[model samples]
Target: MGLGVERFTTQLPEHLHCFVCLDVSYPPVIVCALEHQMCESCATELRKSSSKGKCPMCAQTMLDPVRTSGVLKRAIEDYEVTCRYTGCKWVGCLLDEPTHAKSCDFREIPCALCKTPYQHSRSVQHMLVCPEEVVLCPQGGKRCARKKRCELEKHLSDFCGQWQCRVVQGCDTRTSLANLPAHEKTCADAAARIAKLEEALSGRNETLATILTELRAKLDSLDPTRHASPPRFDWPAGQPAERTVSTCTLVKQLLTRATKRRHRRATLAATALLAKPLPSPHVAVLQESAPASPPAPALA
Candidate 1:
């Protein structure tokens, strides 16, 4: 009548069905002495009932419960089964039953936090207020209200109202995400002032460098070794007067020799003048009167 009954009837072959349970063997099929196949649950029940662990079908004493052959194992895995949960119509391989059970909408599972049973599809919604779940704090948990772990990063970065400015220096202002832009503008002004101060300091360094260069040049000019000549001896002012007197005597001797040479030249000039005879006025008059007697003397 139900889907599960119909699926079991159609999908599971009669040969693979457990002899005791009369259903398809899920896994761990047990083999008795007569090779009669049964589910492990039925085999375990039979062993407990009889003191000697006798097989129900053969009446033989069961020593060790052997597993079903490979052919039976494969056949059991390939058989299709309908979901056991009420109102679920899912039908697939027996091997895939566990996977379908985990996600089945009608199946109930215990919540990780509240420990209350919730349908698998509604488990996520119920976890929001589960008492056992631990969460993080908003505002990066640095100093803000606690929040769910899943929503912490988003709340801190996008929605927290108590977030502080990240500027570590020159400003210790605290502001919310809504006023962060205004605080950043203030920080920008402070940064600009610092840059101006640094530029002025650099200019002052350049001026100091120029002044140092000028001073170095002046010092080099004042160094005496740059214009030095050969050394000469200088007499002291307190030396003996005898050296000065000897210098004056040598000068007077040179002047006396010069005066004697001049007198000798004047004396030679006077002697040459006195050696010539002088013509008297009376002799000049007699030569003029005897001029006519000269012609008669030349004829004799």
Candidate 2:
């Protein structure tokens, strides 16, 4: 009854399902909108409706049925299927045209070194390490564009000899690759930094020694003077003597005081040495040699 129907029917084989209204004998074209048929009437109604007119049969909006072009429909029905590569999960129809090609990730790029197929990202990375991808010298030099690694080394040394050093904050001096090892060996800034470190260590050691010496001297100056001895007791005749004693007890107390002071000084010096960057060994030895009590005179 219509060209749209003819276009649709011509593409399909002799027997296939068609929309119920568009059959050749009863081409009455059942209405989805006023005087419209082929079930597309509902789509026209929905398109014109204020709130999107729905299908009269199901009361669902009919404006957006999926439409397939003739080419696409035939391709899907007749397409033979095979996966492009082993282990691919896809098992169904692959169109011969560029429909699937738009999304396919298997496209190839030529290797810059050898015009062989390689993936684009992988080929770029390979070029970074590939010797054959070497750039030719614009100057008419006898060396081939892809010079052997050994010959390239020699050529670069003789010609573009200024190789960058590996050091961070590197030396600015330019030298041939052959001479880089020697130049780095005697780099003056590196040597100066080492000298400064050595000097700082030496100065710290001297300061520690001086502090320890002064501490020992202070410990030695503790009082060694004698305290008052107990006075002799006078005795009455034939009576047991009532013995009187001076403050010998105080002398013992003084000795105790001196011992504690010596101990405190030794402890302080030990702590000071521990606080130093490098401790002097003599501080430990000196602390061990401290007298347990002051001299005999002080004790008495």
Candidate 3:
């Protein structure tokens, strides 16, 4: 036909050996020991026996690269891979290698249902329907559907629990250290006592007025003239008893009796004036009268 197809063939076809059995035509590319290679699973198994990381076939350090053909590498890039495990069922592109490794078919995640560690592919499906994955009501001693824990606590405290039974009765002020126990015992008692005292003081105002009136009356009842005794006359001394004393004594006695009568009348008048509640003018009169003492008796 056109010159035989074989004429166009080059070494590219010849080097296409399965890196594994070297039996197949195509080999997948993989990385191992910092080198590019094919058949990674076989290389990994081979690593167990040799701590040196030597290649199984060549006994060379597995650090040696077994580069896959550029053409095969490009072909693998176009294909998608899926895990073969039954429930696992993760599927993604070969080009997404790093991403797949991070969240991959073989990766592990804890199960929501059983809490058992299972493959990520299966765990994702299990979590969707898992009973344990359901967030519970935190207020009632379980995780709540409400997003905020604080809100849940408020709801339970206000609406759900026996909060009414826990109602606080009195004001909640912190008493000073010196007054705490005394405040507790007599807080209400002290308030009541203060109120009673205030009421007594306010209501007894008329009684107080009456008492003041009585005190003023008693003070007014005092006799102004009673402040001093009646003046007394002295009998004359060193005189002859018969010649000087007889007529003088008789006259002195009469004058004394007359003076006593005048004094009694003055006292009666002052007592009556004071009893009538004299104003400031009577006080001046009383003071003026008080200074007049009787003249000293003539020597007999």
Q: Of the candidates shown, which would achieve the greatest lDDT relative to the real structure?
A: 1
Local distance difference test, candidate 1: 0.69
Q: Which candidate is the best by TM-score?
A: 1
Reference-based lDDT, each prediction? 0.69, 0.50, 0.53
lDDT of 3 by residue, 1-300 (tens): 111112111223333334554422234433454444545445555556445566544555665454555776565445455533334355554455446566566666677455667677566666655545543344343422432333444455444432221122454544333454455566667667878999999879979999999987787678566457788655445545545568867688768878999999999999998889556887898997897788999999
Tens digit per residue, CA lDDT, model 1, 111-194: 866678876766677776565565655444556666655566576667776655665464667666778888878888888898
Off by over 4 Å in 3: 1-37, 50-61, 64-71, 80-93, 96-109, 117-300
Residue-wise lDDT of candidate 2 within 75-99, one digit each (tens)?
Answer: 3334344434323334443344245
What candidate 2 gets wrong by more than 4 Å, as runs, is 1-82, 85-90, 94-103, 111-114, 120-159, 164-170, 188-204, 207-300
User: How far is each candidate from the true structure, as Cα RMSD in Å?
Assistant: 30.8, 29.4, 29.7
Q: What is the lDDT of residue 3 in candidate 1?
A: 20
The 10-residue segment with the lowest total lDDT in model 2? 1-10
Mark the regions of model 1 whose C-alpha exceeds 4 Å error after superposition.
Answer: 1-11, 124-300
TM-score of 1: 0.36
- Position 72, candidate 3: lDDT: 66
